[model samples]
Target: MSYLDPETSKKLVPIGRFMGEHFTGGNWTELGFLTGCDSIVQNHPRLLRSLSFGDDDYPEACLAVVGSMVRNDPDNLKLIEDYIIEHFSESGPNISTIPGLGPTIRFSPTVFKVPTHPQDAKLVAVMMPFGPSFAGVYEAIKSACSQTQWFYAQRADDIWKDTTIIQDVFDLIFRSQIVVCDYTGRNPNVFYEAGIAHTLGKTVIPITQNSADVPSDVMHHRYLTYLNNGEGLNHLTLTLAQRLRTLDPTLAQFA
Candidate 1:
């Protein structure tokens, strides 16, 4: 939007720096001041100048001022965010998940036209061991996604872009809003991926077959337990669908 409210501005402020920093050769001086922000930028061009030529570690004071400009009238918020999506989607879509807003989530998608899912389905990234034994469990998760109508589930093996599997896993976790980590077998890979997901601030939903398998360090987070059998997996579908619906209320018509 050419203009944004304070709530939206609050969410955009933090990501603005990242957008500006990564838009490939983009300079902050070329940024368009919002409709009501011209005066501020005009009176203090130094802030813009500093951000444009500043080191990677932009001064907090400068960032605070830029944030104030955003709150004032982000007429340029749309322009800047569009550039973010364009550069981010150069190869189909660098960002795979739907953007969003709220206290519990990572992004505010109010104005940005994030292209990965024009359909608006919130992506649920799954971090699980890549073994045939867990195939039934993954299917249950996918079925749960179908129940939500607008949410879908995807695991790392579902997509392949880099020869290095870890890189693709990192990318998936980075783009997803909610991550489902399975600790069924106590696999080291799944545990490591879960750590990465938690560090990224993505809402993590931990599920496991045996509570004993959960690491002691992360036992604080509640987990869903389900046996990998027919009756148990069916129950898992209902539980997961309800959980996912609560996580993303925007498209959660079912909720």
Candidate 2:
């Protein structure tokens, strides 16, 4: 009943070992759930019940379980990588087993986040000080994104999730491919969010009402300056649309 060949399954050991070591915390079930290994978990209900895996006395436990999975279906390897490892880090691990993988797995910082999530290629998150004056500006940007018919834009205040507001903001930025940050008035919160976006390696488009409002350190980056009037908003919409189309290559066209 094995789908993956012996050699192929053997190559996945490093991946399993890496997962066992680094992905600790109550995450085993979430990992299985995210990867759609429901049947595999159901088959060994007792053994798979733990939220934490391979971090205790039996270190090879997770590897053993993953070995069982790949033999049933090699596709699980790619699923775990996509839904887990790559989502966990910007740097994607080589699927191919490398020499000293066991040691190299430790070289990576121990950052375990359960319930992995993927980036939204079409999500454009806007970072700006939430206020009445900025409301028009936000709408203008949203309109600009609508021109692409491919990007969906939203700001932090637009949605409140079950988690803390700050956590919600982190999740939003984490999943976004493009982030638009307004530095007008040099708002501290906006500045902090901009730093987060930059660190996450999102394509940050800086827009401000005045050139002088742009921060000193980030002056190297070009900022789109605009007026918030009816005519100015229209112009901002047109120019921003062009910039977005140029920046986002996730799609050629979307109906």
Estimate TM-scores for all models.
Answer: 0.56, 0.56
RMSD of each: 10.2, 11.5
**How does model 2 score by TM-score?**
0.56
Candidate 1 — which residues are off by over 4 angstroms? 1-121, 251-255
- The candidate that achieves the highest lDDT relative to the unseen native structure: 2
- lDDT by residue for model 2 (21-140), tens: 565433566766765665565565434444334225333556666777765555565566565544465446322211223322222323312214566767889998888888899999
lDDT of 1 at 210: 95
Model 2 residue pairs with clashes: none
Q: Residue 112: error of model 1 in Å?
A: 26
Q: Give the alpha carbon lDDT tens digit for every residue of 1-255 in model 1.
A: 134444545657555556445532233434534235555554664555555676554455345545666555443444444445554543332232323222232353332233343322377889988778889999999999899787788888888877777877776777777889999878999998888777656688999999999999989978899989999999999999888877554433234
